[model samples]
Target: MHLMSALLISLLLVSGCKSTTTRTGPIAVGPGVTQSQSPSPEAKRYTYNSDIYLDVAIPVFNPGFPIDDDTGHVDYQELDELDIWPQLRRAEAKRFAVETKQALAKTKAFGSVSVVPNANTSADLYVLGTILHSDSEFIRLEVTVVDSSGEPIDTEDFEHQVSESFFRDAMNQDKDPYEPVFVEVADYVYELLTDMSEQQKQQLKNTTLVRYAHYYAPDAFAGYLSQQLESKRGTQFYKYELNAMPAENDPMLQRIEVLRNQDMLFVDRLQDHFAVFQHTTNGPYRKWQRETLPEAVRAREARSERNTKAVIGALGFIAALALGNNSTSTSTAVAKTAGALGSAWLLKDAYQANENLRVASAVIDEMGQGLDLTLSPQVMEFNEQEVELTGTAAEQYEQWKAHLRKMYQLESSAN
Candidate 1:
């Protein structure tokens, strides 16, 4: 009886004891989640590029329990009563910053980083975060980046709502403690900050030149013309036109000329009817109506001169095509028109300066498929010139009126 009892006890002891020969209990953890602890070089060895200071205002660690006044402050106890999500989120934010710094350090994106409590210590960048919402099953994180001047450079709001089932699965005893939410948030923040920095740097490097005319202020005149053009069409044309401006170091006079010429054409057409009436009543001798010639006329003239110079510039543009000199055609035409017409170039002086048939031929020849920009003296005298007829002036005026009428008829039929 004694031997049997002793044998039973010995058997129980042997079963509980771990064998020296071999034993299979559980898998050993490595440096990952399965491990009890991971090997580290040292916390201080971690590199950081930018200094970041965190300001966490939201209450942390609440499980919705009543305050325990005897233990500590009532507020602290009340906070403890809330759910654990807030505490988890705060922990996650800190972890995120640390991880981000480490990651950036590996890439050598910045110099060094330091995390602090005070936001007023003078840092290159400041990061502020708020826990807008926190529950057992969901959380909303709002983050903002401000420059040294307290100007907000970037902001983002992200909400993570986990299903009840997901929470249950995630909270299982066997599951890892570091939530998937933490990983996701970290990745989101890292990508956003990196991308923003890169974009800002590129923008700084790419300089935009604002070119203006030499005579008049570029901002006001260009702005006026841009408004007109954009009003007629949309922003698309203006964008293209502005993009077409000369680059930095180019001749300012050349740009001014181009702008003036383009604006002049539009102005000339708009004021032609009024100009004609004015000339018939007042004549072109008085500076095309000094009081009110329409503010656009002056501006347009300025723009047109700019354009004319630009077109005739060394870039090699030909204005007239007499077969012999298509290269210098426009300049040659302007000089001849100016010499014959005198000082009336602002209004359709070209039309009055050229002969009727020659004007028609020139318009057809120059524009090719469109109406000729060239004006004849006879046409100008009838259309724009106003005077009491007597000898040469009257005859010239009468001839211009007749030719313009004929051209008008042809124009109507063609249209």
Candidate 2:
């Protein structure tokens, strides 16, 4: 009886038959985890030397959508079957890029920060961002920076684990829970810019301008810039040099500058469109994030507890089976009986935990349905000519660039 009582008590505790509080344990640290890192990031604003201020261009980010196993593309039927949305991910890629642009702009540490529809824009600096994984509970991004000379400046992966508490605070509701990640990226970029010499900035600016000029008249402007393939930090980029300066009064140069200014103005309008998309998506997206985060946490906890209970229960049954079959004493029989009954209870509790996990997951699925599930076409115009920019954002951007090239060819032929 004494042995039975002790065994029963331990099994009850392991199965969580009485306690309602969730168990906590040590978290596994990642390979990149470093101790004593900068604590809790905040986006700070500062004005730096005007000479080092360089034009920045950010393209819409890669969505990193999961592909269908058979089709090799995102299949809406598969998404519906799994209750997942890749369309939201496509939209999120743009929103994340725009948000980072805003963070950099807030710092006032750089010049002319703008988000272009695509990567065709030539600028003194380019910030490319890719989304790896994003959810209400966590997000991961890979950011790369490059100069106009196509020289890789820096790259880093930033990740954040968000909790329901981040949204629970009343004052923080209107703010991004993931601001720290963006702020950290902006800080690092500003730090890099601070280290650049004025000469380097001017060279990068000129290189970009010349490259843009080459788009219009390659024969005339391409000779002014020279490029050599070089490897830095295990990445290859073309290092550009100014072979010679184009005459200041060159007719082609002046016309190219005018065309470039017009392109920038168009990009500014596109940037505003991106801003509006983020604003409209934000309210509903944040609400869903806040509502579903706790459920996600709960589902994880339930799985953990279920696994723990399953292992313990399996052991309890094995021990009881052995005691019953191998023992000849009556007291051992009593203990065996108790163990068998306790094991049954333990397995039942484990099953309950699994059910809890499913319920929580279902709740998240419903909440996810709140956001509209697709990106849309956009209208773009230049020189009083308008076209419907169709397909993915990247495809649409290529269409716009092609239109620009056609326009340039017409002008050049006439001249």
Candidate 3:
């Protein structure tokens, strides 16, 4: 009778224990897909030889939110006060800028393609982008092109969904998940540049060259090539204006070109640091996601199990006490045995839940430390003036432009 009672108690305890089995679904492979068709022979024949220097600025991460009826605006507040999601979104914006630069270079439409920290950097043309949405499944960007004077030349919206094949390719590390979107953006830019008239191309080149001259020797070129005001119709339009042209072979212009190249070299060095920043953050970020996501899910499951076991254990103890007070001695003994076993299992589960919590805390701490180590302030210098490059490129450019205007005013007054 004692042996049977013991066996029954053991069975009850075993039945109460939570299952540890975890089910992971099978991996799904996508069907193969072909690349887009190439351009026609006639289309391929069109090419330009203009020494156009292009600059791509880091995109703004614009999180969408409904403002009013049928209207939406970017939740800049969310990005400014960042959490993990916002941090990831910011990183995606940087990646988009880098990819755009790479794509532009591949097209060979420009003499050189460079990624600048802000729009204030001098170039024949600039590509600015804002990331409307970006995730593992899809990305959307609003891209615009402008000359050195900030005159809008072209604008387009790019939206791409990650197809099954593209996702599979990214999973296999065969290609970047965002490469398709970058390619489309590049193709559009190429088309825009190719479609431009010779007069437009020459005008952009002249604007860029004149801006350089004005930057280095404002006294000599400021009156001839003013970027202050223009008149269109009856209204005065504020823009970069060229009232007179400089000789193509002027010695002063050649000297300015050399100085500009030296500045570009300095900017290139800064870009190298940005590359390091990207590398350090990207690797640790991926590792953190891989380690913590599954652990978080498992932790929740463990807590659920712990709750179940505690409730069952408490019920058993109450029933055992009742039986002991009113039933036969044998029944009382069996009930006590069952209650003790249940209590023991409950204690074990509680310990496991606590352990999971500790592990989760450690993972978070480690991720925080990694982010702290990698994140640093990026400072850029132009004309020996240091400016901390933060916030949107457009914002930075405005600040820089304001500073330039003040300096010019001060110099003009002194003269």
TM-score of each: 0.24, 0.74, 0.53
Q: List the residue pairs that clash in candidate 2.
A: none
lDDT of 3 at 176: 57
Task: For candidate 1, give the lDDT of residue 9.
Answer: 94
What's the CA error at residue 6 for candidate 3, in Å?
63
Better of 1 and 3 by lDDT: 3
lDDT assessment of candidate 1? 0.37
**lDDT of each residue in 240-267, candidate 3, tens digit only:** 8667678878766766676666566645
lDDT of 2 by residue, 307-404 (tens): 99888889999999999889889999999989888888888999999899888767766665544323368777777888877775556667777777
lDDT of each: 0.37, 0.79, 0.62
TM-score of 1: 0.24
Kindly list the per-residue Cα lDDT of model 1 for residues 213-324, writing each as its tens digit: 4123444335322321222222121221232334445454344344444333322332343233323332221221122122223333444554554434312322222322
lDDT, candidate 3, at 392? 44
All-Cα superposition RMSD per candidate: 40.5, 11.4, 15.4
Sort all candidates by lDDT, best to worst.
Answer: 2, 3, 1
